[model samples]
Target: MTESLNSALGTISSVVWGPFVLIPLLLGTGLYLTIRLGGLQFRTLGRAMRHAFFDGDEEGNAGDISNYQALTTALAATVGTGNIVGVATAISVGGPGALFWIWVTGLLGMASKYTEAYLGVRYRVVDDKGNQLGGPQIYLKRGIPGGFGAALAFLFALFASIAAFGIGNLTQGNSVAAGMKDTFGVDPWITGVIMFVFTGATLLGGIQAIGKITSAFVPLMIVIYVVGGLVVLFLLADRLPAAIALIFTDAFTGTAAQGGFVGATIMLAVRFGVARGIFSNESGMGSAAIAAAAAKTSHPVRQGLVSMTQTFIDTLIVVSITGLTIVASGVWDQGADTAATMTSAAFTTALPGQWGGTIVSVSLIFFAFSTIIGWAYYGERSLVSLVGQWSSLPYRLLFTVVVFLSAITEIETAWLFSDIANGLMALPNLIGLLIMSGLVARETRAYLKFDPKLKKPKLSVEEFTAAQMPNWK
Candidate 1:
């Protein structure tokens, strides 16, 4: 029965994430949003980065966390196994060209990321507890107006709740456990217990705690991993140009089988690239919008721009470093078993002694732990949207328990479950974004026209909310 269920899920996931369905829809929606927004992501990325990393939240803004904290919280959720393991998987299966497609997905995904954040803030509402709650649940239901909108919102929350466990929790926990076991011989149960304690402790404080913790460590973890990757790239400096050429050339012409790598077709490159790209950054998945909605900002457009930078950092920088290092180190052709360990393997080969594996193991553990806390919020919020505030604590407890279980167990099926749930989560969000794109474009253009710097919006949060979303209160 278990095998049959797993097989069933595999079939469903394949179809859900097929080239004709989600791949094109995700790409098409992002393309449409990019066109509608007038290439806003490209134009304002500098300003967006400023807001995300340097700027403080403007006074009188309505939300729980600062822009930087929110960005990091969102970053905490995104920059996990995907950056390391997922990128390696893409290159190994799809070849060097897959990295090129991942870039395409990230580039286009930036627009979709901006749109979801914009709407998340625009349609956000305060709960009875005075908590700032929002996401696709709030936006899809309220932004679209009526039964259809409510249904879409429900589906998003449903899938997100499931994905929070699979993609956000189980997959991360399993990765961390597996990495530790391989590198340090730590028992999976021990890792699971430690994660459970830390996860439960952090989650007790909710988003505020999550925001603070993620902000402190997310940047540090990223820098450590990136620096290690660069060292590997530097050691393989002579092969840099050729590795880059393979990324572009193979993207057009399928990679021929070499070493232990089975040759990949151009279509295979596009498929894994797009799939893992979305998995890594989660630009259109609507999960990040939940964090965006909690950001302290005067206008939706301001936070939206800040939020999109998460994708830029996740895929364009972190994933790029991992992919390039693997390709440059010449270890990506070592067959399917190497996907999870490819990045570390590359680093191990380049860096002397045990430094390479240790760096990756530590980063993977922290990245996975951060993801657990981050997704705990997403899942709890999702439940709150469905069953109201009463479910939040129980859901968090349940989520924590599951984290331990996932760590101690073999969970290959969890990846399949996560892929399907993540894809399904994106569907309603992409559709809603397409439907409400006009609003996203109009508001964005208007906001950018007035305060391109986001230092001060023409109207404060109150005035802006009242003017644009009069019925929100």
Candidate 2:
């Protein structure tokens, strides 16, 4: 039965994620949004960064976290093994052209992520307990008509929550533990246990605590990883121009077999690039919107701008670093998993010796650990959205348990399950986004026209329902 189920899922995943579907779905939505929003993501990126860190609207808004913290939390989940492992996997399988596709996805995805965050904040409602609740589900059910929207929203949240456990937690935790064991010779079980304990402790403090931790951890780890890659690239400075040229050249012309490389077609490059790009940044997956909903801001566009930056940092900066390192070191030709370990090997070979391996291993541990923390909150919110606030306790317990279980699982199965759930989670959310895109455009236009320094628009009596407010301050 499990095998049959897996087979069925694999077929569905192929259909859903195929270029015919996913490419148009993702790129089309982003293009539509970019046109509708008048290229707001590009125009406001610097301003968004300013508001995100320095001049944030930290007036104790009724949300679980501040805008910066929320962005960091989402970034924590995003800038994970995907940046390290997923990029290597793409280049290894899809060839250099895959890196180009990843860049394209990130560029367009910035607009998609901005739209998701905008709608997330605009349609957000406060629960009976004054807690804020918003995401694709909220926008779909509330903004759209009839029982169909409600059903789809419910389904999206349910599957997305499950996916949170798979892609968001288990896959990440497993990678971290495995990396630690491979490099440091620590027992996988021991690493898992330690992760479980640390996750439990942080989650106990709730979203605020989660946000604080991610804010510190995400930026620091990204700097460390990027700097490490820069060092590698600098060591092989002469090859830098050649590596860049190869990404575009091999993208079209088939890469001839070199060393252990089996060569690749343009199709393979597109496939692996789009797949790993989605895995890394997750712009349209609707997961980041879960965290975006919690940002403390008066205008949805403010948070949306900040949200867009996550993709920029994830793909444009971090993943690019990984790609350059692998290409420069010529490690992609080595027939290997081309994920975390391969990237680690590139770093090790590029650097002096054990130092490169040590840096990557440590960085992966921190990046993946923070991802687990961030995704735990996403799961918690999704569970709360589905069941109730009371369900959070048992949900956390289950999440912690699964983190341990994931550590010992086969990497192939772990990645497969993560892929399936990620696809499932994306469907409903994308539907919601498509349906409510008009509203997203409307809200974005209004926010852009209205000055951020101005007082917030007064909520109409109809809009002042308890469902429209947030629980936290």
Candidate 2 residue lDDT tens string, 64-128 = 78888889999999888888877887787778888998998888888889888877877787765
lDDT of 1 by residue, 1-473 (tens): 76897899989977987888999999999999999999988999998898777776665568899888889999999999989988888898899999999999999999999999988887888987898899999999988888999999999999898889988898899889889998999999999999999999999999999999999999999999988888888998999999999899999999999999999999889888998899999988999999989988767888899889999999999999999998988999998677878888989988899999999999999888888899999988988999899999999999999999988655557777888889999999989999999988987777667676777643664575567656653
| Model 1 lDDT at residue 209 | 94
Candidate closest to the true structure, highest TM-score:
1
In model 1, where do residues sit more than 4 Å from their true spots? 1-6, 457-473
Q: What C-alpha lDDT do the candidate models reach, one value each? A: 0.89, 0.80
* Local distance difference test, candidate 2: 0.80
Clash counts for all predictions? 0, 4
Q: How well does each candidate superpose onto the true structure, as a TM-score?
A: 0.96, 0.92
After superposing candidate 2 on the true structure, give the runs of residues whose Cα lies further than 4 Å from its correct spot.
Answer: 1-10, 336-338, 452-473
Q: Against the true structure, what is every candidate's RMSD? A: 1.6, 3.5
